[model samples]
Target chain A: MKAGSPIATSSIWPEAPAAPPSGLARSQHKSPGETVAGRSAVTERAGRARTTKRGQPDREPGLKRANFGRGAGLPTLLLLPQVLILVFFFFIPSLRALTQSVLLSDPFGTTVHFVWFDNFKALFASGEYRQSLVTTAWFTVAQNVITLAIAVVLAFATDRVVRARSVYRTLILLPYAIAPAIAGILWAFLFNPVVGPLAHMLHGLGISWDPNRNPNDALWLVIMAASWKHICYDYIFLVVGLLAVPVSLMEAAAVDGAGPVRRFFLIALPMLGPTIFFLAVMNFIYGFFETFAIIDAVTHGGPAGATNILVYKVFVDGFINLDLGSSAAQSVLLMSFALICTLLQFRYFDHKVNYGV
Target chain B: MVERAPILDMICHAILIAGAMLVCVPLYFAFVAGSLTIAEVQKVPLPWLPGDQFLANLQTAWVKADFSRSFLNSIVVALGITAGKIVVSLLSAFAITYFRFRYRMLAFWLIFMSLMLPIEVRIVPTFEAVANAALPLQWLADLLHVADLWKWISGHDVAIALEWNMVNTYPGLILPLIASATATFLFRQFFLTVPDELCEAARLDGASPLRFFWSILLPLSVSNIVALSIILFLFGWNQYLWPLLFTTDKDMATAVIALKNLIPRSDSEPAWNIAMSGALLAMLPPTLVILLLQRWFLKGLVDSSK
Candidate 1:
């Protein structure tokens, strides 16, 4: 259920531990015949003792404690292994990427020279790179719009339906379990020109459906595959958002002579604005990075770079073509862009989003 | 219930059912394709219904494509990455949460920043790092070089260059992918909520920190641990590019990446049904995890975003 609720608190943390504080509180409650002034003094003393015992760190309930205890050696030793792993796998390589972006190395990497910003300049200058950027922007926008629209509709319908609610939920949410690559393969199989069922259906409708030749068709196929996989995620969130809508507002609107559609537009939509914004940023990121698997599986950046999103282009250049410097430069650019999005989300959207439940 | 509109309710139910069915369309095609024979699957209009050749196709996929071996490889790799990530993250989270060490924030932030640079962004340099790490072999080469300083040292003539090329090994497949930050963040948040009195009680009982960690903290954090495990397992299993990059040896291929290899190249007539069967098999572990641990999976996902 509801995040930040007390449901998760019950299982691990004991509500009433067998400690002196609870025992004292119990004794004080039992002896209710004492004078009001004396009882107040005793309670105040207990509160002070409790605070000291709990220690200086947790006094402010909502504030995260910066320090947990006053020890260094053991904690540092405990943290060393993970720190090493992070250094090797994450930090060092990221630093390498950053450095590589500004340097020029031979293909074999035996010789290197400092060519500050040439790689980045070349990346921006290349038409394919610009096209990939355009494609990424288009894909991110199209996928988010389509997924959010359909998911919102589905969530609304699922929320209104009474019978088989859980069944419908289980069915709708199943796609979230499937990997993007697997989702791509499944959709590709469905849209295969010769053997695909959808292709056959389209043929029956007298529409020539060929992704192999047409760039736009290829683009839309990848977009559809990516969007199809993401609908489940947006649907789940929108469902939660819909359930969190205050029932009283809807009822008040209804009593004020508004129909269900009018009430939805007037009351629910405004309240759901934060959730939509949150899902938009999330879906945009998902479309940006995670859809690489879908593109790899379905289109492989397609006939003449039609569905070549930025992430896929990075893969094509780095992994397939082995163009390391350009790939590294592109990686730096992509990381900066994604980092900006993440920073924006945390800075602006995170605090503003209201999880009403 | 707001207006008791019977017609609207019917419409809602209809749309819900229709949407659910639409969501299932690709999966249904995959299932049916996996059931049919290769010939049947390649028919002008692919079969819409399941065929009796399901077992035959599965057997072919499992044996011919070496799905059995790759499936074992996938299990080992996924379990290895999950265990490594969970252990490393848990220890670091434990350190950061329960202790006020010098430079604790530095360590925490270093780990936290890892979340920003996922494999997609730094794939090339990460590949180089993994390739050149040489790990203990580099130490061995150094030790050998030191030994060769003496003229009478044995085996001086032999050149010792070990690349620690973990191209197809379990360690190579797992380690580069296992240094996770989200898990650490999740565990730290959970640990912050834990009542400090419990730690005090444990300390009073003469239990050392490790004992307290093992007996008290570990058990209390079971839900978070399990939720994180399921998520990491799915993440490890679904990996496509990393495994594809690291493993050139066919036997070391994970099931997800290996599924692509099962597909015939464009020039050849493809074994559509067999590839579909492989896809279905590849999907099994994560799908089963999601279905069985749906609540925890959802919770872990939503909570981690927070």
Candidate 2:
């Protein structure tokens, strides 16, 4: 189900005690003399009052309250402990972090920094910082393209020949199960100089290697590593998109003398565009912050800090260097970058995408 | 009639198989490295073959790295996080979708926006909170009015009863991610697809909200639950950054932090064998989860809605 047609209003909250389900339905239908809108308002309030009574039957009053919680109520209570935990630990801490970035540390617990642009300036002034931002942007764009392309090829290919389609799916998705740190470490060793098996293999093939020393190598390797590690993530999304396309539509296009390429470009691809676009946004974000694993493990920002992405840089500055202020500044920028892109996508492209049911 | 181009298909299959091999190489390397003797592994050219040292290396990794403890620690942390996340996210999704209470949209948006708030950004305050957090052990001690309370509960069930002392426990790793914005988003989107009549029919049948959800909505949404569970479990099991940053207790939590710890120390003090072992150990749960959950994941896309 994509989106439901609303049958009942959310007049009740997180966990209103449930009233009789029948009472709720009856409440929806007006009696012969009752106006429909007026009936709903009265019944909704009555349902609310009944659910609030909790224990023991206020029969008619309690009945109304029960109706309110039945739809949206239960999930709210189940979600409460977690929502509260998140509000404090996740949401509040993030707020505190956000606040710290803006304010100067004071005896009275962080007075205004007042230099609105200073922290941002410090971030921009550092060549390492600017390099990481640009590097991360390039990484996101490149990685998403390669990952999506490779995923499309693999999913389409499997949709044709594979008898054990699910097995291929599982193998491709194996990387998603591995930790980023583990992947980075594993790949780092694979890309090692003079000794790594891959190095030996590449050398035997007369290909120049060394991801750590060359900046281009570092950037490309990070892209490849991200796509390599995340091919399955995109594959899952694309295949879901693929399954959404009706076989009849493709068969009809085939009967009309369309080639596989023509059918794909004209019908399947357009149909899959929404999933693809959603994935582009997903991949873009992953490339922005989530690539630190491969970056850290493979190159540790590299021989010349070439592989340094923003999140890892934040990690180094905050934890390794213990420069909390600059780190907070960098954090704010990273958050803003992500927030802006997500908001822009939602605002502009959201309505354009047709996620198949 | 099909025009089967043998050469092109062969080339494509070759590349696909090669890609598969390429993906497995690191794990192969790790296995090779982990099974070799230290001296063999550190030799001028590393051994490419599986050696006879698997047992010896495993024993050493277990004894020296406390890998068994780390494995147990990971299990607890992963399970705790997954369970907490499932309960919290389900309820939250349920509430946001069905409830018409005050601030429903606001709560939903707050949960929605949270998907983009990187934990790396929140590290400073999270660390501060962790460091100064009231020790559940100390609080219990205060409750008991005993000075040696930490020591008293160090090895018992009572130790787990303390709240703030979760520093090294599974709760520390699980609590922060108990409520996930991503899961909420997914679940809310899924709930939007359900037919309203079923909910209404159940309501008219006298199903309490909880009763209705447990019976009617939840059973229908099992595929969504399964899909969310697999994703959530993998995320929990593979979690590295938060666990590494937040908890100091190496003895009890997911093994990823411990695996990260085992990264070769220096030129003179390498620990690659144990590190690789730990990495492999950390990988098992997620791999197992994926293998088991694929059917459910695929089912969701296939059944969908009428």
Candidate 3:
């Protein structure tokens, strides 16, 4: 595989190099056949790949096999079940959801109506559908803002405050390490007006409370639960982002006579923008899909449906209602909402993030 | 340079302290409230102290779950899934990072997609496929001659209760639990940091490829493996939806689902106190793991996340 000028075997005939193609003519100065598996395959095929359909010896092995073997191949092997499971379970089901959403199911028989946009129409028409979408959007934005703000503050605080920053960081992440459902459930006990300790404490101090029945109260509690779980993600990003910001830059900012808020806004915040952006992206992703666990636990999107999220709606529709098509329709619609947020992120904040990084 | 302002610093500390209090408040409530009786829990101005009814609540939780068995099942499923994931993800990360073969990108993309896409998208198809697989390790009991072996090991037989669910069988609970793209992703990233020159030199010095990995690569990734173990364990242990789907009755893997069920399907007020207790119970393994492995977990997160 080593690339070099062709050599004459006649010039040095004492002993052959191990596994060398050792019997070459004196000065024909022939180029190597370029058909060898390792060397020429990559070099020649590096440019215009010729179509040698199958069994091409010149074709190199996969990225792993050419470099490592069974022991090294373990990750790929482990990933196989993950891949197979994902493909068979996840991808196929999504594809099925797409298909099922189309064919309207009637009492007599299910038929592939190819209704085209009817499912979507039904989604738009349903009052619950629109309400859920708005609620989900509200949750996503509120959760992201609150989580990111807290995370940034905490991250900066921990970075600069306590001597035991790492310990604090772990403790900060403690809420995250617990299951979302469990956290939600725990918060439920804490925030429940009747039974919750916080409410009890408030009541003991003679403050009547009922988050479950009040719309804003219920919304805030659910958002709080969702946001609390992600505080670690935000904190970690900011911490890492803070770490990546060089001490030299901060010293220079300090040397320039800027207050903490001014320096942060003008200099450090700009540098941390990418981290913030990354966190925002991560927050949207989490808010869209993963919030269901916490939502299930805390409110079950309850009181008067103050916190019913889209994914939870999908769960309700598909699992609870046994209406497959509507859920699939909702899932697609949910994706659009996600897409819009993503686009807004890209269009506006992306520039700042890109520049900062 | 800006002068250090003591007030601003104190304010910052105050805010952080407030945040910390906010974070710890629920955990404080969970244990404190877990001790209250049902009537006491619902009573106006909820009990201020750990009531004598803590044991009663725990008993309610324990029996409601058949929880000793549930706990045993969660452990078995968690352990089974963790082992399966570690072994599988080790192989996966290995295959992905080093193995050169056909459709490697295809494989890589599949894993990446799994990470990107939500699990809800896949649960249905996974259910259909797993349901059709017709796998049975029940005879594993007969093979081992002890349907009671797990019972002996875990000191309880919860699977017997959920046996009719068929998912109580090992393959249903454990086999589907093996897949993890995050581990593969992290491992591959970790592997990339190892010096390729060491590998080349080892191969040149007459070591086989497998030997090169065992001697050179894996030993170096001890920290990474430990980190993956924690993540996979938590993911497996806290798994709510997947196990919920498979275990129709109560076969193992049921605490998370049981907690969901505990929310009072009847419209009578759900038992918040006992539910919190059960949740605290479920959070044990992962929390214990975090407390034990925080050092490595932080290092791993910083290393890979960076």
DockQ-based ranking:
1, 2, 3
Which 10 consecutive residues of model 3 chain A have the lowest summed lDDT? A29-38
Model 3, CA-based lDDT: 0.62
lDDT string, candidate 2, A29-130, tens digits: 111111111112211232333234345444332122223443444546666785677666666667666766765554334445655666678778988888
Better of 1 and 2 by lDDT: 1
TM-score of chain A of 2: 0.74
Q: Which ten residues in a row have the lowest lDDT in candidate 1 chain A?
A: A31-40
Name the candidate that leads on TM-score.
Answer: 1
What is the CA-based DockQ of model 1? Answer: 0.45
lDDT tens digits, residues B1-306, model 1? 445878888888888888887888887887898898778888888766899988888888888778888889888988998899888888888897777656877886688677678788888888877887764455665776754654356645654466656677888789888777777766665666577688888777888778888998899888777767887888888888888888888888888888887765578877888888888888888889888877677555555453
> Which candidate has the top score in DockQ?
1
**lDDT for model 2, on a 0 to 1 scale?**
0.62
- TM-score for all models, in order of appearance: 0.86, 0.78, 0.77
Runs in model 1 lying further than 4 Å from the true structure: A1-68, A348-357, B1-3, B135-162
Q: Rate the local accuracy (lDDT) of all candidates.
A: 0.73, 0.62, 0.62
lDDT at residue A324 of model 3 (Cα atoms): 62
